[model samples]
Target chain A: MKQQYGIKDIAKMLNISVSTVSRALRDAYDVNPETRKKVLELTEKLNFKPNKNAAALASGSTKNIGVVIPFITNYYFSTVISGIQEEAYKQGYNIILFVTNDDLDREKTLLRNIATTSLDGLLISISSNSDTQDHFEQLMEEGVPMVFFDRVPHHIHVSKIMQSDFDGAFMATSHLIDNGYKKIAHIAGPKELNFTQERMNGYLAALENANLPRNDDYIIFSGFSQANGYTDTVTLLSLPEKPDAIFAVNDRKAVGSIQALKANHVQVGLEFGVIGFTNDPIATVIEPNLTTVEEPAFEIGKQSCSLLIKHIKNKNHEPHDILLPGKLVIRQSVKLSQDS
Target chain B: MKQQYGIKDIAKMLNISVSTVSRALRDAYDVNPETRKKVLELTEKLNFKPNKNAAALASGSTKNIGVVIPFITNYYFSTVISGIQEEAYKQGYNIILFVTNDDLDREKTLLRNIATTSLDGLLISISSNSDTQDHFEQLMEEGVPMVFFDRVPHHIHVSKIMQSDFDGAFMATSHLIDNGYKKIAHIAGPKELNFTQERMNGYLAALENANLPRNDDYIIFSGFSQANGYTDTVTLLSLPEKPDAIFAVNDRKAVGSIQALKANHVQVGLEFGVIGFTNDPIATVIEPNLTTVEEPAFEIGKQSCSLLIKHIKNKNHEPHDILLPGKLVIRQSVKLSQDS
Candidate 1:
């Protein structure tokens, strides 16, 4: 490897003092314009990048924000990351990405070893299996400025940004009931996730308001995958009395439900209705384009990052929560009757 | 904000030298057992962290890798990142993410400001419109090891990892030909991307092998999006000599093509066939179940990151290219004919 040139070497080469070189590099007024220009030219020519560690140590700012996400393979998470990246870029901050793969153990290890010294702040979405909040509490105790987004812990007293999951679920379920589907089933995500619980409650509330029986057997707890949704739908279809309509936690699961229905020779949009949350791009591709709740994933990311920067700059700032509402997008998936 | 504690403060608390404190934190044998235990206890209690900048200055290793990508709001890229994250975590390295959004200016600016001082290595995928190699040359000259993956620049002298795009395209085209499709149109990505050219070459080769004419008008250049695919397919259908089959660059575009066919009241699987590259999860959601080529995206990410780390460790190591083969996944999108 070639020898790296530091500011000291540049000072020596220019026959200038070390402090003068540092000041000139920092654009301090103590250095002459000619000397500053010489240092800049030489550094640019040599591609001499000052060690970020040393600069961060001296300035007490690393210009790096850590983003910890549960998963990245889904559309919502990926779009959120894009939004975060845009905000971070405009603010001259780089993002350090850490994915827990929705594993509790990995999340614990990741948070434990996170180099807080090299980060200005942290943006996190808790894992589904993170039943205990010890890891987050520890980081908070250490005074690491962090903002949670999307799948956040309910008990955490930090700034949080998320879509109105409850409202979205209510709207989806109500839309089905209004379309003359009294028997509705819900394919939900892991029960441990807070959003899943909220969505379930919303489903129950909608059924209650419609004067329909709340059948526990109509709900299925599974993973956030198409396979899970397909299996759950198959199980529901096997029941003595099956649901007239199905509401999925996400679009992927809804797609799987539709596939399951088609495989069983059931007519979608006519006989068995289906609705999905998170209006992913796949919604349009599916036959009888799925009706869904449009989640503001990108906006959540942009707002979370923007808020985190504010917290990073002002330590005394009070933490708050921001909940963006989801919009109902009616498509061909659910059929509407002439009567209310 | 509370006063951030460092190794110096921990050493003072434990009544030890800064070097001994650092060595103890690093689990070095030179430190006494009792003193090391005391240092660890104090540091843990105070949440004191070693200055990454200072440590990098003393030892050239930062234990950080930079990942430069074109886009993230897609299944392929996001899944690739998941693979990269898995490997990076196992290797005990942190990943810094930079997104170019497939824009040439963003790519250039990102490369220009990339701080080599804080990163041990870099893993990159060049943007489609990136025509300049000067920024990459600058990084290479600075002795910062980097490895390119997927959409890489042709002129760079670095370890590059990518899937066998040509073979995938050839197989897709050949499958269409075998299914009695004489006139096939291709929806290609941007013309500047090397992968696009390679895919086009494969498409042309498959036609020549089948003794079919390669129509220049059959190929359309556009961005990698479902909307682009839809518009391109519409344009192709408007021609006097319409194609019997359409091979899209990706599954998103393939879905778009299918939608266009459906809108035009054309029988997709029976009359007009559609095959796609990158067997994205959406393939199953689309009606007729898209037949496509599955690229080894995860393997590409893992191999690219591993190679980058090796280069970072051994500066004199020769750069090599890795091209993993893709497989054809048969589904219901194309019609099957019994020949044997």
Candidate 2:
């Protein structure tokens, strides 16, 4: 009636696919820069602004971001959420939470029923048990902007941010080796997680650098918990050639290892050395303060949220892979010198 | 159009107020039972159903609940959230989270800008610094259902749930006295919080029952943190007459007190004794393992969520006050006996 035009009309005039015009309108990175420039120029000349699309893109319109995580009752995750919340609050956005309790089925179900209309974007940390990318792929196809942090799927081509697990593990293993521990054991997380695999590879690389033999029995892959660490340590202790030191996937597991070693009347700092990833508060509380790699959890959360907002605003934003480094925190858990 | 009778018509026919008819339709607890029955019978006979109103009352119409909390980084709050998430998930409700970081201004702003249209109800634990109930009252006036948990306002007539702080504190102090610790000191939370007052009262009641002196010098009120506990303990130690035992409001403070006492070369389990509330995991990790009263954090969260759902479904549901009991958990922090 009033010479109103749609993206379809723009596509016809430019001799391009409707999707290409739509992507161009949203300033998607995949769209050719020259083509996007032309599309914007033509739209500005024709005053081709769709009311509903304009309103949807307005600042703070549905100013909410959904965060899907595995658990909230742990130090690492809760601290990460704090960082995300701080960033989101500063940017005038609200966070809606969905917890999967590390169960894949619940993660799938939660993702399936997420109300995309109410959320501007999503920040997800895939569950440890998640083995498929189909659920996330479907959401992306429906035009829901998302970024994954920490535990993430392997194949999805989206923004992902996490701590440098491989580098941290290498540092942890090298620290143990430097402390004069002859044979070292590793308590790892679930075998399926790529981070765990990366950590294992780091541990392997460190052992190879030091010209140590690879003992499959010394590496135990299990769940991420103190109990897992305790059981894994007990299994190591029962071996014919017990390891003199242990490197845990996290501080909780390291604490468990300490408890198990202490229970067996072994001197934690003297007879055996222990190193952990994630310098959790429990590291200080444990009898012998734990030596660990401090993950850049807060930075990961902030950057992931910021990257997600970019995607939400510009639909064609290029995917990014960010890996923040971790520092080794020296403490009493590992022996300081061979003489001591 | 067929003569569709609204709630106003039903109220006129029954010679009752429109508000009364509306409350009766929703099975409100405050209305007279006989009046509600009469209104229901009349509505049934006349087939009086308002489409929009009925649709608003339908199950799962807005299957989202907002959870406003002070902090998610602590063990107590995180455990409570786990319970809330479990209950809400079971009821097919998604949770939207708001963290105030225990700041009153942030809490007020969060409450003021909360989009009621997106949430069916709210589950809140006000910040430690919040000194007013006006924001909550305004939300109630808008007919939004809500339930307060843990840290709640004093006068609001809303469904509130918390632990039996007084009883737990009394038990902790009494345990100290029974073990022959004289000159017991209490390190507490913010004086403005009712729970902290209740805990202080419990400590006083125990001292009175034991014929011990009521010394204001022995009580210190401060923030709830390990740092607070450490500073308070340092202050206590500097007094001309030092305490023989310390009863902390929470385990974090207790751990700090232990650290301070240990630093001062005081034997925690021998020359001095320490007891704490909220048997946090840190309680076990602290040297000489802390003795404490375990708060029913999970139960409080589950019950608060369940109660909020009741308020959401039935607008007339009565406000409730629930206090779950805590029990004494004995460990090595306190001396076992006077002879020892």
* Predicted model with the maximum TM-score: 1
Model 2 agreement with the true structure over A178-201: per-residue lDDT tens digits: 878879899999999989998999
Which 10 residues in a row give candidate 1 chain B its minimum summed lDDT?
A: B22-31
lDDT of model 1 at position B19? 80
Q: A28-52 in candidate 1: lDDT tens per residue?
A: 5667999988987887777676666
Model 2 pairs whose backbones collide:
A28-A316, A29-A316, B28-B316
Task: Report fnat for all candidates as fractions from 0 to 1.
Answer: 0.79, 0.43
Candidate 1 CAPRI classification by DockQ: medium
Q: Estimated TM-score per prediction?
A: 0.89, 0.83
What lDDT would each prediction earn against the true structure?
Answer: 0.88, 0.86
lDDT of 2 by residue, B1-340 (tens): 1336777788888898987986676555678999988986886577454332133334224567899999998999999998998888777677888999999988876775565655789999999878988888977876789999989899988889999888999999999999999899999999998888999999999999999998999999999989899999999999999999999999999999999999899999899999999988888788989999999888888899999999988999999999999999999999989463
Error of 1 at A182 (Å): 1.0
Q: Kindly provide the TM-score of model 1 when superposed on the true structure, using C-alpha atoms.
A: 0.89
What are the RMSDs of all candidates, in order? 5.2, 12.4
Cα RMSD, model 2: 12.4
